[model samples]
Each structure stands twice: as C-alpha cells, then as structure tokens.
Target: MNVILPTVITAGLFDSLNPCAISVALLFIALLFTLKKDRPFILKIGFFYIISVYLIYYLIGLGLLKAFSLFGATHFITKIAAIVTIIFGLLNIKEYYFPHAPIKLRMTHDARFKISEWAYKASIPATVVMGILVGIFEFPCSGSVYFAIVSLLASKVTYLTGALYLLLYNIMFVLPLVLIFVFATNRVVTEKMINWQERQGRKMHLILAGLMISLGTIMLLLYF
Candidate 1:
C-alpha cells in the first residue's frame, strides 16, 4: 500500500496535539468525565467515532479517485491537481514550522451525537450517520488533506488500485488516533497527552506535513 494513508493517519494523531486536536481531546475528556462515563465506555465511543469518520473519509477518497479517472483529466488538470496537493501539503509544513500561522481546527469531543443509551445495533447506525455527517461537516477544513490523497490515488494505474490506495491511506491515518485513544483511556498515561501537546506538538506536525508535501512533490514531479 502507498504510505499516503498511513501518513494521513499519522497526521491525524499528531494533529490531535495541535491547538485543535488537543483542545478537542481535552474537551472530550472533560465532556466524558462530565457525563460520568467511565473510561471504558468513552474508549468504545471514541473507537466507533474514529471508525465512523475514517470510513466515510476513505470512501470519499476512493470515490473521488475513480470519479476523476472518468474525466481523463487533461495534462493541465492532472498537473493542477498535483500542484494543489503540493501547495496544501506546504500549508501543513508551514503550520508545523510556524505554528502560529492561525491554523485552528474547531473539533469537538462531543461525539457528533451521544448514543450510550442505545443498543449496539442502534449505535451502529450512529457510526454510519456520524461518518457521513463528519465527512460533510469537516469537508472544508479537511478538503486539502483529502485532496492530497485523492491526487496521489489518482496517479495509480487502475481504479481498484486507487481504491486500495485510499483504503490503506485511512489505515495509516488512523494509527496515531488509535494509540491515542488507548492511552487516553488509560488513567496512567492520559495526563501526559495534554501537556505534551502544549510543548512539542508543532514539531511533530512539522514532520508530518513536511513528509506529505515531500511525497506529493515527488509524485507531482514524476507524474506532472
């Protein structure tokens, strides 16, 4: 699998540390605590939450890759997509290096909706609904990152390959978040998360953004 999805997964986890993600995580933690929801329950909700968000995002990426193939993008268009990915990737790099660049992600730990009272099957629908909602809800902010992957997948030889590219992309993208959810659920390790984000998060983000841009640039050059 192309590393792009994994790269995105890393980005998402690291992003959790940024002003946005940390804030969301903290607020989420607080929110969970407020509801008297135990760590175990919170963890389960978050697990489904991540799955919901990722599945929708991954499907969108896959669909877009296939959709664009039918367009048979003109050389100009393909190059343009490559260029956009490069630029958005740079935005990530900029945020990494100079975090004060007014980058803010207004994420909520609010679960998009809470379903603790519902049965497992009812909650299953919540994932589908939440996935679709988050996909549409966060599109504007996440469009560039999503586009970066789409552009890369579009470079593949076949639509199925492109679909697989996105599938892996989502997996990679979720890596950090899963680990985080694990730690966040652990009473022992949770304290470290918020403070770490405050001090060292930007550099982590820099590394992530830089890598994506670099890969995007290389691909752009090769396929431009």
Candidate 2:
C-alpha cells in the first residue's frame, strides 16, 4: 500500500488532465458556492475537498490492486478482467464523444465515520479511507493504464512498491487541480479560469474519457 500510493497518485494526476477531473472540481466549487454564497472559506474548503477526494481516490486504488492480484497474470480471471477492462475502455471512448451518452460513475462512501474520528490525529486511517474512495472513481478512465500497471507490477513488485506507484500516479493526476487551486487562490485570476473551465468544460471530459477507454483497450488486448 505504501508504494502503490505514489503510483496511484501519479496516475490520478495523469487522469486529472482529462476534462472530467476539471469538471468534477468545477462542479464541486459551484456546489460549494450554491450552499454558501461567496464565503471566504471556500478556497480553503475546496482545498481540503481536493485532498479528501484524492485521498478517497487513492484508497479505492488499493482495492483494485488486491482484486487484480487475486486474478494474477496467467489465469481465467485475469483474462476476463482484461476483457472486461478493455470493453469498459471502449465504452468510455464511445461515451466521451457522444454528448448524449455520458459515462455514468457510481460512487460509494465506504469510510467509517466513527473510526475516522478516532484516528483523526495521525490521519492514518483517514488517509487510507480517502485513497479507497479515490480509487473507486476509476470507472470513467484509466482502464488501459490500470490494467497495464497492475498486471506488470502484480507479479514482480513488492506491495509497498506498488503502493508508491499508486500514490505517484494519483498525485500526477491531480496535479492540475492542485495548480488550479493555487491559481484560484489568487484574487484576480480565479474567476477567469473557473469561468473558462465552466464554459469549455465538456471538451476536457470528452478528451480524457476518450484517452482512458482507448488506452485501456490497448492494454487489455496486449495483456490478453
């Protein structure tokens, strides 16, 4: 999990370049404003929100790592996972360009509130839970990358190394968002970028979604 964290973070940052990540972040800010009009705390709240979202995403990745491991590299399950992943990837591509056929992501909160409160100081459990949530966000993209990375590392790397990879992957995926947050913190430019993202947002989503499905299909085919 330790090493996989980095991989997942970097991968996540890569995926973040996709328009979907931008849209999600934008939507979150919009929602925040709707709830509390122009509150000064928004930027900070949004910052934590990004952290929380990424944390959740990273954690979800761990489960994926385990599932792929159980299937291994040379088994029926691996073949099937590969097939399904490829299919999902292709489907994502189709969904990307078609405005009418958007990919539907089902998100679940598996974090335990009580335990999180108890573990708040060091935030060990909280961080793990956050990563789990982030990983589940994987439905729309990275099927190709996911398959390839997992398959390649599953048999060879130690669990900690894998975790590092995951952490890095997610960090990269969210790097843009991190940057956006930084830019937004600026009083003058914040509104402009947000407005730009809001207006031309769909392009990002479509493109990123396309990348995920296309690459996922490739990885699936190669592995199979």
List the candidates' TM-scores in order. 0.71, 0.63
lDDT of 1 by residue, 115-183 (tens): 222223334455456445655555543355566556555655578866776666666655655777777
Clashes of each: 5, 66
Query: Where does the lowest 10-residue lDDT sum fall in candidate 1?
Result: 113-122
RMSD of each: 5.2, 7.0
lDDT of 2 by residue, 11-33 (tens): 45556765445554554445444
> All models: lDDT?
0.58, 0.54
Model 1 pairs in collision? 5-169, 6-172, 8-173, 9-172, 9-173
Off by over 4 Å in 2: 1-11, 18-20, 30-40, 71-82, 102-148, 186-190, 217-224
